[model samples]
Target chain A: MTIVSTADLLAILPELLVMAGGCLVLVLDPLTAKDRKDWLAYFSLAVLGAAFVVGYWFMGALTGSPRPAFSGLYVLDAYGAFWKLLLILVSGLVILLAKAHLKLEEIDLPEFYAFILLSLSGMMVMVSGTDLLVIYLGLELMSLSLYVMAGFKRYAPRSLEAAAKYFILGSFSSGILLYGISLLFGRTGSTTLAGIRDGIAGLPPGDPILLMAMGLLVVGFGFKVAAVPFHMWTPDVYEGSPTSVTAYMAVASKAASFAAFLRVFLEALGGIKESWRMLLVAVCIATMVLGNVVAIVQTNIKRMLAYSSIAHAGYALIGLVVADAAGTASVMLYLAIYAFMNLGAFAVVTMLRRGGLEGDEIDDFTGLARRNKWAALVMLLFMFSLAGIPPTAGFIAKFYIFMAAVGANMTGLAVIAVVFAAISAYFYLRVVMVMYMKEPGETAGTPGYDVRVVASPAAIAVLLVAALGVLILGVFPDPLIQAAQSAILPLK
Target chain B: MVPIFFAYFALVSIVAGLLTVSLRNPVHCGIALLALLGHVAGLFVLLHAEFVAVVQIIIYAGAILILYLFVLMLLNLKTEERYFHRRHAWYITGVGALTVELLMVLLASRFSGAKGPATVAAVEEIGNSTAIGILMFSDYLLPFEIVGVFLLGAIVGAIVLAKTPSPADLSGDER
Candidate 1:
C-alpha cells in the first residue's frame, strides 16, 4: 500500500470540509430547537463561504501539482479547481437566494442545507473525476440530492410529479451511464481515464466496445446537459423545482457537469474524436434549435426559462464541439455570464411573487415595469444577456463561442447557433415588452399596494442577482474569460 | 468456486430483481430489492472485489434501499390494500428485460479484454482498496469534492421547501 500524503488532503480539503459540514448539519439538525434550526442555514453558508476560499487556495495548488496523493485516485489540476470555485460561489449565492424564496413559500427543513452541500460536493468531485467510478459516484451524489430537492414541496402535487418523472428518467439514464462505465472498465481493465486511454490506444480503431461505451455515455451526459432527444425530463423537472433551486440546476449543475463532460471526452477519449465530433454537433444543433423554438410558446415563465436553458446548453456545447483552447474559454465565459443572467432572471420572478404560492405565469409579469422599474430594468438586462443582445455579457459570450467554432472549421454549426440566438431574442424581448407596455391591476388586499411596499427577501436576492448580471463580468469580462482559458484543458 | 453457487446467485438476482418491479405492494418490492442487493453483493465477492461487495451490502442494501422502504412506508403506499395500474405495465417490463439481457450479453463478451491488466496490474494492491483509493485521490480528487456541495444544495432546498411557516409569517404579521 502507498502512503497517503498531507498534500493530497489539502487538494481535497474544500470537499472534505463541505462533506463533513453536510454530515455535521444532518447530525445537529435533530438536536437543535425548532426556530434555531435556521441557524443551520448560517452554519451551512459559513462552511461553503469558507470552502470557497479553500477552492481559491486549490487554484494555486493545481498548477504543477501532479503529485499522486491517494496514489492516483484523485488529481489536482486547473481543470478541477476551476469548477470547484464556480460551484462554491453558486452554492453560496443560491443559499442566500433561497433564504427568501423558501421563507416566502413558508417551507423549511434543516435537512435541505445539508443535502445541497453534499450534492455540490458531488459536483466538485465530478469536475475532477479522472476515474470513471469516481464520476459515477459524483453523478449519483448529485442526482440523489437533486431528486429530493425537486420534490421538497411534497404537498404540491406538481412538485411531486416532477420529482417522480425526474427520478424515473434520471435513474434510467444512470443505468445507461453505469453500463457504459462497466463496459469501459472491462475494455480498459482499469477505470481511470489514463488507463482507459492506454487500453484504447492498444485496440484497433472503431472498436465495437468503445463505440458502445460512447453511445451509452453520450446518452447519459446528454440527459444531464439537456441535449436533444434526451431532454424530455428537463422541462418538467426544471419547471417543477422551486425557482431558486431551478436557478442552481440551470447554472451551477449544468456548468459543473459540462466541465466534467469536456474533460472526460477531451482527455480520455480524444483518440475517438472523429467519431463523436459529428455526433455531438448533431446533438448541439438539435438542442439549440428545438430548445429556442419551443420556448417561444411556453406560458409559464419557469418552463419558458427551462426550454431557454436547454437552448443555451446547445450554444455552450458548440464551444465543446469545436474542441480548441478557445472553445474551452468560450464555454467558461458563457457559463459565468449565464450564471448571472439566468439566476438574475429567476430572482426577479421570485421577487414578483407574493403570498405563499409562487407567481409563475407570464401574465404575472404584466406591468412589472410599473410595479418595480428597477426589477423591470434588471429583468431587461437579464433577458438581453440571455438573448445574446449587444452590450451585454450574453453577446460577448456568443461571439467567443462562435469564434471558437469557426476556428475549428465548424462555421455551419456556429451560423445555426447564431440564427437560433436571434430567434431566442424575440422571446426574451417579448417579456420586456409585456413588462413595460402592460397595465398593473389589483382587486384589493390587506397589505394593499397603496401602502404596503416594503422590500421582501426575494427582492433583496434579486438586487444581488441583478447587480451580478449588469455589473459583475459584463463590464469586466476579460478576467473571467481569461480564467476559463487557464482553468480548462489547453487545446494546443 | 462452486458453479452451483454462481447459478444460484444468478437465479436469486433475476428473481429478486423481478419481484422488486412486479410486486404491487411497495413493501414487498422493497424487501425483494434487499434480496437483489444481497445477490449483487455475492456477485461482487465472486468477482474478488471485497470492498465493493461490502459497500453493495452496507450502502446499497443497508442505506439507500432502506431509504426507499422508509419512504414507501411513510407515504403509506399500502393504503389501497390492492395496488392497481394500467395493463400497459407489461410493455415497460418487456423493454427493461430486453435491455438488461442485452447488457448481460455485452458484458459477457467484455470479460476477456480487461482480464489481463485487472488481475496482474492490481495484485500488488491489497483488497483492491489501495488501487481504488489511488485512482480516487490522484485522478478523481476534483469530482470527489464537488459532490459535497451538490448534497448541501439538496439539503438546504429540501429544508426550505418543507419547513412550516409560523402563523406570524403566514398571517403577514412578522417580517
Candidate 2:
C-alpha cells in the first residue's frame, strides 16, 4: 500500500512548488553570472506567482469542509488557503521591495531570494499544519532562513548583533514552545489537534497540567508575534537588519505566525475558552498599552514601526479574546490589511537610500516632501492608514476587530483598544508631520542633506500595489469580509 | 533494583547537568556534558525507549560532544577569571525560586493522561526501532519530510553566515 496517496501530493502541491523553487534558486546562485543575478529575484517571483495560482485554484475545494491530508497531520481548508494566499502575496511584494533595496545596500546575494522562497514554503506548511510538531518544524524552517537573511550584510556589526540576538532568543522561544508541546503530549497523549481536543474533552476546566501547557503555548506564540513583554528584540532587530528583511519579518512572518496562532488556539483549545480568554485579555491589554506608549518616544522610524507591529499584534489578539467566528474573521481581515499598509510603509523606507548613508532615522524625513512629493504622498497614505484614519484600510481593520469584540460582549476590551488606537496615532502621524511641515536642510545635525528617493520600477510597483490594496479594501471590503467569514467556518 | 538504577541515573544526570554549566574549564564542561548525556540515555533506556536512548548516545555524546571539544581545542580557550559576578545574585535567587516553585507544582499535580499503545510488552514484540520507523514513515510522514527542509535551511544559513566573503563581496562593501 502507498503511504502517501495522490490526494496527499495534490494537497501539498503549492508548498512543494515553493520548496523546489527555493532549491532551484540556491543551486543556480553560484552558476549565474554576477551582472545577471537580478534574474534570480525574477525567477523567485515567478515561483511565488505559480504557487499563488495553484493555491488560488485549490480554494474552491477548501471552502466548506476541511480536508485532512497526510494521515490528518495537515489540513486543506479555506482558513489555511486564505492565509497562504495572503502570505504568498506579501512574499511577492517583499521580493519586489527587496530587489532594489538589496542593490542599494550592496548585499545583493542571490541566496537572499532562495531564503525568501524557503521561508515562504515554511509559512505555507505552518498555516496548513494540523499537528503541533509539524507546525513547530515549519516555524523552525521559517525562522532559520530569517535569521540568516537578517544578517545578510554579514560584515556590519549591527547586522551580526541582530542575527545573534534574534537566533538566540528565537531558539529559546522555540524550546519553550517545544516544552509546551511535550507537556501537552504528556497530558493528552497526542500532538494532533483532533486528538488533543478529544483527549482533553473530559478534563476539568482548571486542571493544572492542561492550564500550564496552555499558558506555555501562549507565551511561545506571544514571543513569535512580538507581543509586549516578549517584544524586546523587535526594535533592535528591525533597526539593524536590512530594510527589505525587516519588511519581510514584520509583514509576512507576523501574518503567518498569527495564522498558526489562530488555528491552534481556536481549533484545538476552543473547548476551554473561558479558561484561556482571561489570560489573553491580560496579554492583549499589556501589549497594546506598552507597544503604543513606548512607540511615541522612538527616534528611528524602523523602531517605531516595530512597536507599531507589536501593537497591531495586540489588536489581533483582541480577536482571540472574543473567541468566536466573528473574532477569527476579524483577525484575518486585520492581518490582510496590515500586510498592505505595513509593506507600503517599508517600501518607502527602502527607497530612502542614497550614497553610503542609510536614511533610517526619523530625521531623514525632515524635508522629504520637498525632495520627492510623490514619495511623500504615498508615505502620507501609509501613515494615515497605519494610524487608522478614516478613508484608509487601517480604520476598517480596527473597526471589524472592535465590532467583533463588542458583538461578543467584550465592550470593555473594545473601548481599551480604541483608546490605545487613538494613542498610537500620535507616533504614526509624526512621520507625516515631519515630512510635510519641515523645510529642506532645516534639521540642525546635518547641513546640505540631499534626501533623494531611489525610486526604482520594482519599488514603485510594490508601492502602487500596496497603496491600491489599502484604498480598495478600505472602501470595498465586502469580498474579503465574505472570504474571511467562510474561512472561519471549519474552526467553528 | 529498577528503582535503584533509576535513582542513580537521575541523580548523576542532574549533577552532571549542573557541572556542565558551572565548570570553569571548557574541556571539563565538555566532559560534564558527556556524562549528562550518557545518564540521560541511561534514563531513557530505563523507560524502555531504547531507540531514543541509543540515538541520544550516538548523536549527542558521540557527534555533538566531539564537535564541542574540537571547537574548544581550536580556540585554545582559557579558564575564566571570574565565573559569577556579585550583580548576578538577584538573578540567581529569582531563578532558584522559580525552579523550586515549578518543582513543587510538578510534584503536587497528578498526571493521569491517556496511555498510548507503546507498553513494554508491545515494544518488545515489535522492537523499538521498528516501531519508531513505522510511526515516522506512516503517521509522521509530513513532519518527517518537513524536517528535511528544516535541516537544509539550517545548513544554508550556517554556510551563508560563516563562509569567508568573496573578493567581489568585499569590493561591493567598499563601494
Candidate 3:
C-alpha cells in the first residue's frame, strides 16, 4: 500500500486554490448586497490570478519530470500545467467579459463568477487527474456549474430552455461515459489509467468488450467535444445561453475535455489504437463535413460559431488520429490557439448588444465596419484565424496538425480535413463580408436611424488580448510550439 | 439459492423498468422506478455487495424516488393524450440500434471466461465498506475530494437555478 503524503497536496495546489477561492466567493456573495456584484468578479479574478501564479510556480518546480501523486490518481506534469495555465487564463478572461456583460444585463448575482471559478477548478482537476473516477468527478463538477451558468439569466425563457437541454443531454452523455468506465473497470478490475494500460498490455486486438468500451468512450467524448452526431445540443445551447457563458463553455470546456480525452486514449488505451483508430477516423470525417456544411446555413452568429467550433474539434482530432508525439503537441498548440480565436469571436458577439436588443443575427453585423471599424477589424482577424487563413494563428494550428497527419502517412485524412476546412471558409468569410461589405440595417424606432453600438472597455480589452494573441501566435508560434512539444513529452 | 434470488430480482427489475417508461401517469412511473431500484438493490445483495445494496436502497429507493415523487407532484403534470409522439419513432429506432449493438458485443465477448486482473481478493475478508474506505482515504483520495467539489458545485447550481430573483433584480437597477 502506497502512502499519500504532503507531496500529494502540493501537487494539487492549483485545484485547491481555485476550489477554496470559489467557496470563498460563494460565501461572500450573499453577505454582500446583490447590487455590488462587481466586487465578486474582482474577487474571482484575483483568485484565478493566484491559481495561475501557483500553477506557473509549480510547473517551474516540477521542471521536466512527471510525478504521479496520491498513488497515481493525480499527475503533476508539464501537460497538466500547460492546460491548467490555459484554463486559468481563459477563466479569468471570461470573468472579465462576464463582468461587463452582467453589468449591462443588470444581473447582480455573484454566483455567476463563483460557478465559473468552480468550473475552472473542475477543469484543472480533470487535466491533472490520472484516474478515471477523478476525471469523471471533475467533468461532472465542470458540467454542473456550466449548466447553471448557461441559464444565468433565469428570466430569459431561452436561457431556461438552454439549461434544461444542456442538463438532460449532458447528464445522459456523462452516464454513457460512466458506463464505459465501468465496463473497462470490469475488464481490468482497476479504474486508474496506468492500471488499465497494464491490464490490457498483452490482450489481442479487437476484443469485443474492449471495443465496446472504446466505442462508448468515444461516443461519450464525442458529445463533450461537440463532435458530429453527438453535437445536436451545441447550437441550441450556444445560441440560447448568455454570450459570455457561451464563450466560456466553448473555450474552457472543450480544452478540458480534449485534455482528458488525450490522457485517457493516448496513455490508457494507446495499446488498443488499432481497434479505435478507425472509429475516430470516421468521426473526424463526419464531424468536419457535418459541422462545415451545417454552419453555412446558420444566420445566428452564435449558432454559426457553435458549428465552426465543432469543425475545429474535428480538426483537432486529426492530430490525435496521428497518435504520435508531434501529433499530441500540435493538438495542444491548436487548442491553445483555438481558445483565443473562439473566445475573441464570442466576445465580439457579446459586444454587439446595445439598447436592449440582441445583436445575434448575422444581419445585425451588416456594415459593422461602417459603424465600428475597430470591432469589425478585430472580428475580421478572429474570422480569418477561425477559417485557417494564412498569417493567422488558426492557419499555423491547422498546418501543424496536418503536417503531423501527413508525417504519419494519413494523407487521405489530411486532404479530407483540408477540403472541409476550405468549405468552412465560405461561412467564416460570410461573417467577414457581412461586417465589412454589406450596409447596416435600419434602426427599429425610425427609418435610417443609426443605432449606437456600445461595448464596455473590459470587453474591448478581451477582444484586443484575444486578437493580439492570435496574431502573435500566427507570426511567432515557435515559443508556444516548444511549450506544447514539452507538454506532451510524456506521450512520446 | 443465490441464482434463484438473482433471477427473481433481474426479472422484476426488467419488468419494473419497462413499466417505468411505459406508464402514462408520471406518479405511476415514479412508483415503477422505485420498484426497479428496489430490485436492483436486491440484485446487489445477491452479489454479496451488502454496502452497495444498502446504498441503493437508501439513496435510490428512499431519497431519490421520494424526490422524484415530490417533483412530479410539484409540476402538476396532466395525463398525456398520446403516449408517444410521431417524432419519437426516431427515439425508438435509436434505442433499438443501441440495444442491438450492446447485444452483439455481449454475445461476441463470450462472457464466461477467466476473470481479468482480479485486484480485490482481500475485499471480502476486510468487508466491502471498510476496504472502500481504506481505498478512498488512500489511493482514491483525489477523486474523493473532487467529489466534494462536485457536490458543492451541485449545491450552488441548485440555488442558482431554483431561487426566485430578488426584488433588486426585478427592478433591473444597475450597480
Candidate 4:
C-alpha cells in the first residue's frame, strides 16, 4: 500500500511549492554571480506569491468540513488557509523590506532568502498541523530559521548576542513545550487533537497531570508569542537583529504561534475551558500592563515596537481567553490589521539608515516631516493605526477584540484592555510628535544632522502596499471581517 | 535477573547524571555524560526497546557527545577554580527544595492514562524495527518530511553565520 496518496500530496501543494522554492534558491545561491543576488530576493517573493495563490485557490475550494491528511496529522481548512495567506503576505513584504536593508547593512546573502522561504514553509506547516508532534516540529523548523536569521550580521557583536540569547532561551522553551507534549501524550494516549479531546472528556475535571500539561503548554506558547514574563527576549532580539527580520519575527512568527496556540487549546483542551480561561485572563492582564508601561520608557524605536508587539500579543490573548467563535474571529482580524500596520512601521524604520549611521532611535525622527514629508506621513498613519486611533485599521482591530470580550460577558477584561490601549497610545503618538514637532538638530561632524531617509524602490513599494492596506482595511473592513467570521466556522 | 539489571542500570545512570553536572573538569564531565547515556541505553534495552537503545547509543553517546568533546577541545576551555559561588547558597537551596517537592509530587501520583495499541506482544510480533519503519513511513510521514526541511535550515544557518567573508567583500563601501 502507498504511504502518501496523491490526494495528500495535492492537499499540501502550497507547502510543497515553498519547500521546492527554498531548495532551488539554495542551489542557485552559489551558482549566481555576486552582484545579481538581488534576483534571489525577487525569486523568493515570486515563490511566496505562487504559494499564496495556490493557498488562496485551495481556500476557495474548501468544503464545509475540514479535510484531514496524513492520518490526521495535518488538516486543510479555512482557518489554516486564512493564517497561511496572512503569513505569506507578511513574509513577502518582509522580503521586499529586507532587499534594501540587507544591502545597506552589508549583510546581503542569498541564504537570507532561503531561510525566509524555509521559515515561511515551517509556519504554513505549523498552522495546518493537527497533531501536537507535528506542531512542535513545525515550530522548531520556524524557530531554527529565525534563530539563524537573528544573527545574520556576524560582524556586529550585538547581533551575535541577540542570536545567542534567543537561541538559548528559545531552546529552553521548546524543551518545556516538548515536555508538556510528552506529559499530555502520557495522560491522553494520543497526540492528535480529536483524540486528546475524546480522552480529556473521559477524565475527571482538573486532573493534576493534565492541568500541569496545560500550564506548561501555555508557558511554551507564551514565550513564542512574546507575552509578558516570557517577553524578556523581545526588546534585545528585536533591537539587535536586522530591521527586516525584526518585522518578520514581530508579525509572522507571532501570528503563526497564535494560530497554533488557538487550535491546540480550542480543539484539544476546549473540554476544560473554565480551567484555562482564568489562567489566560491573568496572563493577558499582566502582559498588557507590563508591555505598555515599559514601552513608554524606551528610546529606541525598535525596542518600543517590540514592547508594542508584546502588548498586541496580550490584546490577542484576550480573544483566546474568551474562547468563542467571536473571540477567534476578532483575533484573526486583529492580526491581519496588525500585520499591515506593524510591517509598515518597520519598513519605515528599515529605510531610516543614512551613511554609517543606524537611525533607530526616536531622536532619528526629529523633524522627519521636514526632511521627508511622505515618509513622515506614512509613519504617522502606521503610528495612528498602532495606537488604535479612529479611521485607522488599528482602531478597528481593537474595537473587534473588545467587542468580542464584552459579548462573552468579559466586560472587566475589556475595560482593562481599553485602559491599557489608551496608555499605549502615548508612546505611539510620541513618534509622530517627534517627527512633526521637533526641529532637526545640527551636530558637528555627525550624520545626525543630515538624517536622510534612504528609500530604495523596493522599500518604497513595501511602504505603498502596507500604507494602502492599512487605509483600505481601516475604511472598509467588511470583507476581511466576513472572511474572519467564516474562517472560524470550522472551530465551532 | 531482570529486576537486578534494571536496578543496576537505573542507579548507575542517575549517579552518572549527577557526576556529569558536578564535575569540574570538562573532559571528566564528558566522560560522565557518556556513562549516563550508556546506562540509559541499557535501561532502554531492558524495556525491550532494542531499536531505541541502539539509537540512543549511536546518536547521543556516539555522535552528540563526540561533537561536544570536539568543541571543548577546539575552544581549549580552561577549567575554572570555582564553578559556583558561596554567596548563592540561598538560591541553590530554593531550587533544591523545589526539585524535591516536584519529585515528591511525582512519586505520589499514579499514572492512570489509557494504554495504547502497541503492547509488548504486538511489538514482538511485528518486530521493533519494522514496526517503527512502518509508522515513520505512513502515519508520521509529514513530520518525517518536515524534519528534512528543518535540518536543511539549520545547516544553511550554521554556514551563513560561520562562513568567513573574504577581504574583498569586507572592504566594500556598503559597510
By DockQ, who's the top model here? 2
lDDT at residue A40 of model 4 (Cα atoms): 90
Q: In candidate 1, how many Å is residue A232 off?
A: 1.9
Docking class of 4: medium
Please give the distance, in angstroms, between residue B5's alpha carbon in candidate 3 and its true position after superposition. 3.0
Using lDDT as the measure, which candidate wins?
4
Which model is ahead, 2 or 3, in terms of lDDT? 2
Q: Which pairs of residues collide in model 2? A: none
Shift of residue A240 alpha carbon in model 3, Å: 0.6
How does each model score on TM-score?
Answer: 0.84, 0.97, 0.95, 0.96
Instruction: Indicate whether candidate 1 or candidate 4 has the larger DockQ.
Output: 4
Clash totals for all models, in order?
A: 71, 0, 0, 0
The 10-residue segment with the lowest total lDDT in model 3 chain A: A443-452
**Per-residue lDDT of candidate 1, residues A1-492 (tens digit):** 344567767767887888888889988988999878768878998999889888787787666444444556666787788778878877877777777777765556667787778888788778876777777778888887878878766666677778888889999999999998888877777877777878888877777788789878889999998889899988889888877778888888898889878877887777788888888999999999899999999988999999999999999999888887788878888887888788888887776654434667676777778877877888888898889887888888888999999998988888898899999988999898887887765654422123112256645765566566556566678777767777777442
What DockQ does model 4 achieve?
A: 0.56
* Candidate 4 TM-score to native: 0.96
The worst-scoring run of ten residues by lDDT in candidate 4 chain A lies at: A441-450
